[model samples]
Target: MSPQPPASAAALRARAETAGLHLPGLILAAEQLAAQVSPGAHGLRRAGPGEDFWQYRPASAGDGMRAIDWRRSARSDQDFVRDREAQTAQTAAIWVSGGQGMAFSGASDRETKAERARLLALALAMLMLRGGERVGLLGQRARSGRLQAERLAEALVAAPAAQADFDAPDAGALRPRQRVVLIADFLARPDWLPGFLAQAAGLGTTGVILQLLDPDEESFPYHGAVLFRSQSGALRHESRDAGALRGAYLARLAERRDWLAAQAGAAGWRYVHASTGDLPADSLTELWQMMGR
Candidate 1:
């Protein structure tokens, strides 16, 4: 069996009780990372000698018993943590592409691409948030700095399965100096990537573009004649030329990968392309180390 998690990881089994669901170990493991960074929240809770201080407030009907402060209750007639004002954390925002394409899983038995994406996104988000960095989620419904992992997971499941048109983010919606992490498969047309990177570079912001893809995306593993369909169902193929087109198809894919890497180098962005088969924990930890974390 895996060794017992760090004591700080108590937040996980604890969070599930609040969410009224059995959240996965992935989230708990990510919470271990989150403990590194102090997350900011608005509420009534005890403030201790932690590097990051959080104020708690009177218990709302929804607060879990775990979040309650029995010590404060013993002192005051009211049950609560010290209700402090809401404060913003100095955290980087993580924008995960929620296009339908992420929902695909080529042949992974553990989970689908979308599932992996969720695991990665949530883990990263929690990790950053723990370090006192506010996490802003970008998708069809963008939200940030909220203790809503369970809600976010549900949203990921219901989100529309289409890559963004790869265009500019909304004007002023993205800050230039903030640390920004962009995670996506980036399988869509490549029209908007240049502008996106250019704008981010101009802001003097350093970040990573985590491109998550299946093995097949890198290697066209179609050995036999077969029908293929895009996530959008806009394209359908009945092909017998898998061998004939294999060469051209692979060449085009290489060019695209090279183009993406070249663009990142030009704009001073860290690029990490992760395969679904990769052990996400190790890959993500390596990424942080590469970032000089």
Candidate 2:
């Protein structure tokens, strides 16, 4: 993969302009939705070095004087050792498919698959940040906090072109023991998935795949005199009657989803499907619940 495009001043401004119409709303909605989920739900619980107070235990042999809480010891008449919760934040590597197919939207009321996937990524990042976890784009290094989300969102929108039909992310970018989330239409025949999953497993990275599809892509609700144009504009198919293709299309879609689920299981990851028409908050909530578990 080529080096990530630097976020120069011009590049940042162009990214902002590219997403100007959607950015504000996306950010606000993400913040509001993330606020609904409590951070403690995903916090790591243990006793170790940390800032938050956990509890006090009776000081024992080998305990250093610095470990004793003098104030607490005076009150209890016994030497007490301060213990703090070791809240180790997890790293979540996130990816959104920017395939040409993702630009397809079935209706004016709904956002394009790419738009919905990007917004979902941002929203999920907000939730992870609030939970005290680190987040990064799949090919990038992870970072924590709200500011990182802004930086990521900017970079996501700034990329000049969509990924190839079956381009897998660079697994070398992933750190061991990290969690990953991928949001994509999954319309392409994925020849690269098995190798990618194998590498991810080798790196000790567990993952979740969020399959986002447009309503029309799922239902195939079209009839007479239908013409379909490929998102890449490389092909066109015209049909005297599109309804005739519904059965086969639906079957193929089901098979694809099933294969995705099975492969995710084999790789020790979970898969979830969401339609573009559904509430983004609901998907975000479900993902958070799954990660916490």
Candidate 3:
């Protein structure tokens, strides 16, 4: 069989626009998944400087006279200080890989890796927004509120696809003190990742890397004769006994994941592995809990 032709620039743009048409549905799915998990510490309930009253605690020796709430003290025998909820919002930036490789799916029943990544990214942003945290795409300005979530969904769906087989995180976009979430397959062995992590460390930016993969990629369930082509049709491989490759493939995959985990650890960042076939809510819940910490 002849190699497939690459998609024309116009065709790629049209495809991206078509993807935009599903933004509403995608956002709804993400919202539903996010709703499954409670916001927990992500919410603005921590005691700090804020307008909303959080709790009243007994006055301590260090408490200033003016800090005491006389009205609350009058209600109780002991002096009390009114504590307000923390209004400070942390900034979270999310990036979903747009590489053509992400468009691949092992089976018709499973979502494309890109779709799964986008869903998780958007859902995570929604949850963060609910907790009063500012959220945005990695290269965009982080903002808090319902509108920001909508914008994030649009951006995730409408972004142009990467021409390369593997897309690297844009480390140059790192902002100081920003928490980032990068969702990608990481199968291409991104040479730029080490540099990106170094840059993030320099900027004091901490984050988590959620490596999303198709179940087929993880299990290597090929058998007999098989023809493998990348989504971009830029790479091709034919095997008469594909099953013979399983052991080596699995070993390499494990090595890749180990490398990723090590790199993330060196940077004081978290690393998570997820398969597209798994329940998205399960992954979302894990991410939600991790982000809260």
Candidate 4:
């Protein structure tokens, strides 16, 4: 597939200025992506104390007499219990890392990690909203409806640039039993992560940690006489034979991914990995399934 054309600075600024008045291109793209997935029974069609009818099943020993549909039961020899669809909307908070490292793209044709993260976050939020779930930024209150999706897009566009090389999730923003989606490249191993996961477990907050990386970061395609610099220019390394470091670099990357996966599992959450080169819709499909679970 052809790469998406980069947005001009002037156009971006104009879109930001008119954010609330109309849907931005980013939101439109997210909507298009979200529309691709079918919103089939998204864990909301379960039997519960809701107004809408879900299904009818044979009455069991524990089934209360009030729940028994006598009208329907009369037609059949066995008694049936009326089940209603669960109407409780789940709250989801999505966070994209605002780190300097996220702004780096390996090539002009590829999107920056930040760009991909925001797109996925917004698209996932749109899908959840379509499934009758409330969504918002990590630090904000979750709300339902199309307006909330628009507000999430606006918030993502207006987010301030990063001043640091890496960022950690805001544990204080988490609420009990709230679902969260955090998208970031954990190259630096956020020192706050362990504590955050512990707190999330304590509060019963389940979530998914998505590790997004640039193709260059994943492959480390450097050769002789290379200089590597952090996105913030806070750190630098020069190597006469950069290709020789590939083995060590890849090993560390794998170790980090394993560590993250273990942490997520320990906390009853899930871990997902994706690269900018992959299709956003593919990752969104996986996220949709995880959220439904």
* Reference-based TM-score of each model: 0.63, 0.78, 0.82, 0.83
Candidate 2 is scored at a TM of 0.78
Off by over 4 Å in 1: 1-26, 32-89, 108-110, 139-158, 163-172
Screening candidate 2 with a backbone cut-off below 3 angstroms (N, C-alpha, C), the clashing residue pairs are none
Ranked by lDDT from best down, the candidates are 3, 4, 2, 1
> Over the full model, what C-alpha lDDT does candidate 4 score relative to the true structure?
0.87
**Candidate 3 deviant stretches above 4 angstroms:** 1-17, 43-87
Query: lDDT tens string, model 2, 1-293?
Result: 87776679668777668676665677776677777665553544578767778788999998999989999999977999988877678898987776788888999978898777777788788878877788899878789977897787776676555644334566677778888987888877677778878888998888898888998999999999988887877668999999999999999999999999999999989989999888877877787777765
For each candidate, the alpha-carbon lDDT, in order, equals 0.62, 0.80, 0.88, 0.87
Candidate 4 lDDT at 243 equals: 96
Q: What is the C-alpha RMSD of each candidate to the true structure, in Å?
A: 17.0, 7.4, 6.1, 7.4
Regions of candidate 4 where Cα sits further than 4 Å from its true position: 1-23, 44-59, 64-87
lDDT of 1 by residue, 1-293 (tens): 98987776776555545444425555675565445443334221244334344565787787788868898788778778544333444445566665656667777474666666667777666655544565565523334444656555544444444453232344244565656667777776556777877777777765677777887776777866888887756667888867677889778767777788888778777777787788877656655643432
Worst 10 residues of 4 by lDDT: 14-23
Instruction: Quote the positional error of residue 256 for candidate 1 in Å.
Output: 1.6
Please give the lDDT score at residue 207 for candidate 4: 91
Best by TM-score: 4
For TM-score, candidate 1 versus 4, the one ahead is 4
Q: Best candidate, lDDT-wise?
A: 3
